[model samples]
Target: MTVRNLPPVSELTEQQQRGWSCVWCAAPLSTGTAINLGEQRHEPAFGSPYWWFPRACPDARACAKREVTGDRR
Candidate 1:
């Protein structure tokens, strides 16, 4: 079997810009806010990428979970 690598967020199709929210806690993530994802904690990275979690928040776990679980509460 072969493993196919996925592209980075920079390469993915851009989605509509929306307010940042935590995947696990469903809390809104903003600048200087702390977001916990499993074993890691994330802080916001402000730059051209706009709103994004730090490297510690790999794979956008919170975002993915929301997609898969369809929790629009």
Candidate 2:
């Protein structure tokens, strides 16, 4: 599925990168309840490339709402 471009990895929290929270809203998400956005690869300037998993709530609208309003849940 298509999704908006993710925020820069440097700006994301550990939970967001680990798929434990919504990437956009920063809301906690139960396993199997979030939509996997797929693994992302990052090539740092001084280290080997690494991958980070990103997930989001099933309801994109709600996620966006929470993001815009700063309502993390």
Candidate 3:
């Protein structure tokens, strides 16, 4: 199994960059108001590779934690 991650905004494809709202905080996205969190790809053998594009709001801070396994929120 292998996983591929997307590049920064400058290297993102046009389709990948097409977003009117932020993927993280639901903020208006534009050339000047977007925080590119890059894209990611989850590879699977059963179907097409799942592609994910995450964009953060201007006021949002960057943080990362381990993936939650169950209902811990």
Best by lDDT: 2
Displacement of residue 51 (Cα, Å) in model 3 is 3.2
TM-score of each: 0.25, 0.92, 0.42
Pairs of residues clashing in candidate 2: none
Residue lDDT tens for model 1, 1-73: 1222322434323221122444332444553544332222223365443443321212355555765686643
Q: Better model by lDDT, 1 or 3? A: 3
**Candidate 1 global TM-score:** 0.25
By TM-score, the best candidate is 2
Which residue pairs come into collision in candidate 3? none
TM-score of 2: 0.92
Rank all candidate structures by their TM-score, best first, as comma-separated numbers: 2, 3, 1
Q: What does candidate 2's lDDT look like per residue over 1-73, in tens digits?
A: 4689999988999999999999889999989789999999999888899999999998888888999999997
Choose 1 or 3, whichever is better by TM-score: 3
True lDDT of residue 71, candidate 1: 65
Ranking by lDDT: 2, 3, 1
